[model samples]
Target: MNRHVTTGFLPGSALAGADLALPGVVPLERRRLQCYLALLFSDMAALFSGFAAAGWLYLGPDGLAQGSHLAQLLLPIFLTVALYNGTYSLHSLEHALSGAIRAQIALGLAASAVLFIAFYTKSSASFSRVLFSGGIILSSLMLAILRAQMRSFVRWRCGGRIIHEIVICDGGVPIVLPGARVIDAAAHAITPALDDPVSLHRIGVLLRGVDRVTISCHPSRQRAWATILKGANIDGEVVDDAVARLGAQGARIVSGHGLLRVSVGPLGLRARALKRAFDLIFASCALIALAPLLLAVALAIRIEDRGPVLFVQRRVGRGNRFFDMIKFRSMTQSLSDPHGHRSTLQGDPRVTRVGNWIRRTSIDELPQLVNVLKGEMSIVGPRPHALGSQAGNKLFWEVDERYLIRHALKPGLTGLAQVRGLRGTTLHEDDLVQRLGADLEYLDGWSIWRDLAIIAATARVLVHPRAY
Candidate 1:
């Protein structure tokens, strides 16, 4: 039986030659950004409310005039110092709760110190150091407490909400769905053949198959279930009811069904055009500026081994078209045991010393700049997979048809997947799954800023050890 899973929002139309049902996971960075924004808005509101209350209570009487003047003078400066000291920009604030608190404290101390220095320098006669000190302490405490409380509240509220739609295939156990009643005996049934499509479909037809199921387990499991549902072309909501019901007890089941009605459509041409323009402009400038280094790398490759410096391999590109991808060769000439066609694994004997260096630093990818110039690729999009890579096969056959959405845009020289440690050899199914998920995510959330960020991250990772 063919079974697939998916989570979160489904696309409007399926891409040709791609799986229409494989579940794709949302990237951590995107999720963190959303959570951070929610926290920020809530915290800002809380801060203003606290300030209003404090003003009404402490400054409404004798302190009103002096306090107003002091606040006007100090607030901006304090905020600036706090931001600097805290490293409290929108970027850094995406970390976990404890990290945020530690940052806030550091910011608070620096802000307070800056205010103290400023007041001393000005020799402000009307300013009371005690009042200023008290305000800083109180403000810091309020901000920290409010942020923490809001974070907890948001998590709790979301815990009960359906954040994703998951479909279960390969009947392992009955999935429980939030707000769903499982009165039928089928709710508790487990089919060993749930992974198989024919058997699962038979079960679905027999039970007039359920529309939604819930499983109380780890968040990772929810993600897995969503993937399975997506692959099966069945869409249903994933709720936290299982978690709520299980709550440190035995495992709990929610509800899920075979009925999934969701649209998977291609991105509009306008977005496609915008991304293309961005790619041409940036790729052109980068290639021109790095010409000297690229030449040197080519020369090194040739000198080390008397083989083609540039390697051209067939890769699946936009619209499932075959394209010869260009890259610096990092492998020695070799014969395949089974066949000549195979992926290079880590520590492969075919890798030369220079090849290893180029691969690790991603210098081998430099020639793809020419591909970008020719309009075969973008500066940031999904990295094109080799035609025969295991990752490509799984994505094509096992995932949803919309999984090809990543190919809607031109293949990129550097992509969200590569920058997030999804590059290199795929020795595990999870690796390919993760890389494809990042690729789809890039397509869904494509933007100029995001492309730039990926490029920056790619540069950073190239210098790091794990990139190899």
Candidate 2:
């Protein structure tokens, strides 16, 4: 069961790797753009040809000239209305009848607008009303036929629908979707976890570039899956008939199953762009400003134990993926806990004099600015933790299921938990609970102003007592 059951995935597919293999499905967004352009071009051609043919048959060259003018005027207006009425949307791409009807409505509106303008401008005599009406009817028929043919084109081009959908079966009733990639979660050991990097990474790989994700999981695991999906930044749905009984807010009935819409991306495209730009600009400036200090620390670390000046440890980052986090080495090379299996206690023998001072002042973490520049971390978000990080006698995720939700955003150098003085090791379950609460809170209604406030607040805690 090392490899989960995957349908539609072909050998040598572009998205395949040693860990997971996916079908060479074109991205849904790109597919939709292609469909929209096809429809637009076809519609333009149909409109012009239908009107020109009618005009040439009715009043010769004079009518042909008038029809060309009419089509030019109608095209822009029709396109505008069609865009608003879902004529060129995903629903339209999926349902030919619905899209065709919407297209007719848009065309009707554009014709009415053209007639209204002609009447008001005393230009009604410029073209024969009967010929114009005839042209509209002919165009309507052509457009309808064109839309019907589009169904065949879409079936050929997109395999029917212009979206990528996946279904995950996790200890629940197995179901089928006509064209969706289905995965058996248990076969892959893909559980929703905050600290289990393997599980998170596997899940992330499974979901990359998916537009819609539907989960069928046991009732006990629904909440955990919901949290994971929220951080995944996709359209997430959970199948459960009892959602109505529980009063799920975003629930809907799809194909006879009750689907609870658990999450859309936490940040929209514009917001993510703004945040990334902020991180890059600031991280680059900080690195340049502190270059001399960074060199001094690195040189000192090398002089101490003659070990590598930087400690590179694998930590869970955004989307629950692992990344090598950089930090100035603070402990003896032999004693460093790469997996963070052990907490550093006060007066620990492994801490050298320089290591102790840098750890106290939080200077050892300065190298993580490089991680920020590399886009592996953020300046303000929930901090990433080592895979084996734990609280009390259990892993951090084992102590609290909601611990994973914080990972929806990039791991930050200083986060809400750090600003709130929750930087120490999770010695007990309650310690994790307190920090988890802060991390979850920070995920809500994120804004640039809030990030700046957190960054300002973080300065106060740089020399906090818990830095050990």
Candidate 3:
């Protein structure tokens, strides 16, 4: 059965007749729901398997005692998967499968280590080490295989078999079908390049002709295509090969990487409001919970340098408002370069010893909790841009006007951009553009659960620094 599911990412109006749409082109609503459900189910199954395996291994007659350290360790490992599994969905299954498997293995090893420590400390009775190790190996393999299988199933079920009728507006460039069919095609007076100004007038005409539209172009042309399509009334889909646009929505089979840029517009007002309420409540609680840690970090910073404990700098907030964002001082006070620096170059000398550690560990950002409590920021959203950062100029000014829509919500402590390693500074104009695109994406798809997931993932990354 074709099920119509709504998501925080797509408007309900976009869902009309979406099931009949073509491959590489479904209403954003359906895609978001499908992706979220797939991730949710996979995580549920993995958690269940982990717990089941642990119980069978440690609680059975031939197993280790339930009260043993092995059992305690295994329980936490299982809990870890249950708590953190949602973060894995941030990446496409193909790219993250190996890493997910490795993480499962690491969880097993951590559990084993905890058990060993317990034994060494005489906190538990002796257990069959061989059996325990065997259990770990068996459970790890089983979870990995199950996760892989789940990913495969999701891919198969969501693959394109459905076809959508799309109106194509080609301004005279030889339109290549690449095998896909266009229900109706037209040539406009102005042939708009992907990077060129989108012909909203042309798009409105096309939307009236078909339920959806697909714009195919070279990779370099993608940004422009996206910009133009964003203004169109109809939902837009992208295809690596222009021909694939003719296939059924949710049925076209393509590599995951090709689907990365596919996105829809903002969620409904209700979802946005719900997300804001959630951010306020959660950010408040987080600030309260982390208050002690913040105090300790403040003391450390003060002792390390005779500078301000809290660094307040002008940052672009929601709706292009300028706010003095608060953070633990992680750099020695220095004036910005006269050239109007846009990004922090690698190994910036402005970083002090304590600053380096704090930045790496993300402890320097603890003071942002005050910002959160003050309702100037969120626990999760797009990270606020520095006052003169390239992203502010390129995205807020040069890109599509819709890009500024992201500022409608409060700035976030961590966001989809940061988790995707779009943090730090944009070295290139393209990078800033892409970062803003992601920010706009997050704003369009804001949700309570999504925010929670981002925050959790941020915690994980903070524990293991990669970008810094």
Candidate 4:
């Protein structure tokens, strides 16, 4: 039986992509940001007020001291931690209950820290336990109240609509979500093209200015546009009816047709910030530590052929943006082909003597740490590919949709595929598929530990025969 489906995505994912929106409203992102900031201040005030009230009730009129301390130390800690945890990100706090829970978690963590600090300072006697307990309860309650009242005002300000959702569906049926707007685009026509400049340009234009969700019923279309959507941190959804058909690829399924909206980018808010922070710190340290080695390599390349020591080329990256990737010049400067044809064979004649040693030892790649520092690349992710890079005559993206999915993340200095010996030529279809699979796996299951593991594996791969 030939079955037709809206998208090959999970049924859960289809409805999960639905969002509420109003016509003529400010771009959705800006609205959300404003709401987040408003609520952040409200939360801070609510916490402070709660503490002050508790102090007055339990510790006489002088309870403002503890409230002052909490405002100074604990409040900042809670807000900072919450920012990374994504509790308040992506408008997840629109729901009063969700907002309340997130507030409680942040406050609870901060309150616990205060308890420990009091014990450590041997000042538990100075801190009023009754007021402290009361403050926690009161703060949580007030924030929940503030969120509920604010949601109404926010919705009113966002166009006075109770249900503001945008949907893309294949059926002749009504928009599944109540009071949602649907944009009709046939599933087949929405197939995403990788290198087709016209299509890429059109998609970007069409999806721009849409602060709310830009949805589609084609999974490949969603995947191809994934980079743009992720890069902008805007919303894009895959709508499908077949529960059995949707392979999450790397996306997590959080609900059954009612899942929370998830970022197409694999890493969550906090992890991403930490990863970028780590990249900056690590890249800075490496550049400082390897200054001598980098200089020596540059000198060697110059002394050998009197050519440019660095080889920079256009490479596709996160959100499909192109950047100049820098590497040590490893091929003979005269024979260097930006549009490469010769494979890195066991003994390629095009490789200069100095180039061969640098390429083999992975010293040629040291310059990319600068890209990491510049925010063009990451320390770990799918390695970026040259625009027309191919296996035989077929490009990597030409092979399958999965290859394009790798761009959902920023390209990396080292990747899971390279560490797994999938570097060099893409001999056949499986080569691209497996390599894409590894990249997807890394994105889906990423953690600090996994990143560390990839880094360790990268070190081993540098000396491996496959690296050449």
Candidate 5:
């Protein structure tokens, strides 16, 4: 499942230092997804096997009914617990024992929850005591063995294959490492020409083939370096501490490379799945429930303004990717600034008669449920900004160095900042800062229930003064 490569760099090559770093990619999603799905299937198989074994060992055919009851009630909960604990993350799978423990805990917790509910509801007699107890014990032992074997497979295949890379500045000091391997049997690097923006295609081709690319930049060439980083559609690690300047922490040390990537927040595998599921369920239901309301809003906008009903604009999202966010047109199309360099005032002349009401009631934002379904935005997250969004005289990113941190998660239809009264137009530096603070707060402490709470709280402030 991994690439086999012949080492390219020579032993005498000057590849060392903290200043030499690799540009990153989103990582091997196809591989990761395969691994994740395999683990999930493995768990299911083990659960079933254990249950089947226990049923036969306990009370014959009647015990089979007991196993079914427990499995039907507990599987979803167990999966959810595993998701919350990052048990299925590609990053976490390196240590298989931890994953197994989390899995075991998930099963135990689900079993316990069911046990409590069954007892409290006066339904304990419905479950076979022998089957329940035996199933749990057998499942735990089998899962632990499976996990250990999986880890052994990974260790046997990859443990010797990862390389300890050293990226050093040309003519700078070189350090020595004890267990560092100069060559990797499992992975390869592709360093393309970085002379100009014209070389972007060559870089992109190389990036598609490799996990990492070492980028070396002098302190004086920050602008050129940033330009290169911006133009390339890859995760970048700066040799300089610029990422540290931008509020990213070292996630982990990989293969003895001390360099840490600059990231706004931890990218989660489970969070992506959970959020997508939540958004699909929530958006689909809300769309169905509010069909008439959506239709009415569209008809009103079209009739009142004699213009297109929907307003669409490009907004920056996670990892600086841009997507068109849709809304009911709430302003005079001819006069409205789509790039939004200037903040909207409460009584702006650009606001149309229908626009005012829709904007105030947040009916204009209802169309973004499609964006949520499209996977461009979440039901709850930091609201995205237009390309030229400004706070006072400065660009939004210029207002706060941490402004880009908001892009770490998907932009939302409604966010913590909005419900907390930091919505409307950003008229001052403090406005964006406060909203940023709220967004950061949400990011730092995110959960499925937290998102639900935000969604619920959002209904209470749907018609706030700051909304316009």
Candidate 6:
């Protein structure tokens, strides 16, 4: 199956006499190692040159080498910090700003450390204050400007491929990776046979210059591929659709069996603490600020039909458990659909006059602040759905098996999907599809900053046209 779907500057080789001819991919590890060394040397030169230049300008020709001592003292510290901060790492090669910011941080930390040492050691008087200040300013500016141009430098040095990565398809889902070479295992006789020396040799040759290899294959073949990858001594990944379907965070072999970690909580302890604190604080503040409006809406709903002011309906929440979600009563008491089997439609006869206005402005959902305060819901997450909710004729879970994965986190009053106007009714399967996609994306990456942004975006859609 060895076809070069993505040429990536490597010319595909023609088969010769039953032998697999893999395209020549220059080993990338050496190139990346060389790039790292180049950055280190360039940084050293920048620091030394900046100091020497500053010394000349500030202290005349007599002090051309005056700041050389400081440069020498700071070089190791800066390089060590830069390595840890990823200034000379692969991510730095991709984005110039990432590397520049890291470089600046490294330089700042190094300078601070040197000055702190000098101060405590009573050696501050030895170095001229003006020379030290001028050196730091010049070196920092040079580093930032130099790093800004390193993207092109790395591109030139590494040629077209920054990482020699390849994706080998072995009878599984086909995937496209931007800069990776694609190979077909069947076309190349690349079988996962441990006993077949010829096939093992073929695999080795194909992976010779590669840094990382990803195989997309059926579950039956995954074990074989995993065995081969482990012996190959390269970074490897086996694509399993089950991992995504099960929301598995990672996998590990324990007690002579593999375990897929699907039960892990979305947020870590620290993240949970931060999110809970944020939910409580925001919900509390919002409740107080909107009290007058909440009271007015309640009064309106109560007076409209002389019915109960609040509607409590059973809906799915975090951990796939049932919770009574509260909202302003929006339908005639006798006509209210508690199980949500029937989605409300525009001009639905059951909706009262007050229900129309409150639902339109999302005033009806304000009562969920109590849910947030009770820790049953988050300020932002996938919105809770009633058990009987349907997308078209199919129940939501029946329409898509991944629907329940949304319950891994607490349901929210506002969510990534809702803010994007994917709220209101799930009229079609496609509607749920769009919302589920957004919900899964939110689950993949949760951050307080993103939550804040979603909340801010929610304000714009409070009175969306889709509201019934």
Q: Which candidate ranks first by lDDT, i.e. highest?
A: 2
- Top-TM-score structure, candidate number: 4
Q: Please, what are the lDDT tens digits per residue for candidate 2 over residues 150-177? A: 8878887787567789899998767777
- Candidate with more favorable, higher TM-score: 1 or 6: 6
- lDDT (C-alpha) at residue 229 in model 3: 49
Least well predicted 10-residue stretch by lDDT in candidate 2: 1-10
* TM-score per candidate: 0.43, 0.68, 0.42, 0.69, 0.65, 0.51
Model 6 C-alpha lDDT per residue in residues 1-468, reported as the tens digit of each score? 111112221112211112454567877666776777777777888899888878889989866768787788889999889878888877777666887888889999999999999999999998888998899999988887776666677888788767787879999877766687899988877787543323544576677677667777778876566545544535566676466643444675423334343333456434666899999999999999999999888888777789899998766566444567999999999999876778899899999999998889998899999999998899999998865677887777666656655766889989999888897788789999999999989988689999999999998999999978
Q: Against the unseen true structure, what C-alpha lDDT does each candidate score?
A: 0.53, 0.81, 0.54, 0.66, 0.65, 0.76
- Write the residue-wise lDDT of candidate 3 on 1-468 in tens digits: 001111211223322233333345433334434654565455445544544466466566434343244545565655556435443432443354654555575565566666778678996455555556555665566667766666655556544422234534343222333334554333333343322112322333334323345655555555545545443323466655433433313324343323323333344434655666776687677778988888788888788887678776665455334456877777676632312234555577877777778788888887887787777787777787643345444533344445544655677888888887776666556776777788878866456778778877787777434444
Kindly indicate the candidate among 3 and 6 with the higher lDDT: 6
| lDDT of residue 155 for candidate 2 | 80
Cα distance off (Å), candidate 2, residue 191: 5.0
Residue-level lDDT tens digits of model 5 in 33-123: 6667778878877787777779878878877776766766777887888888777864556566678878998888878988898889999
Clashing pairs in 2: none
Alpha carbon RMSD to native, model 1: 14.1
RMSD of 3: 16.1
In TM-score terms, candidate 1 sits at 0.43
- Which regions of candidate 5 deviate over 4 angstroms? 1-34, 50-216, 219-248, 251-257, 264-267
Off by over 4 Å in 2: 1-18, 25-162, 186-196, 244-249
Which window of 10 residues has the lowest lDDT sum in candidate 6? 1-10
lDDT of 6: 0.76
Compared with the true structure, what per-residue lDDT tens digits does model 1 show for residues 332-399?
75532111135676777987888888887888888898898788777877787653455443433344
Task: Name the runs in model 1 displaced over 4 angstroms.
Answer: 1-266, 335-341, 391-396, 399-402, 464-468
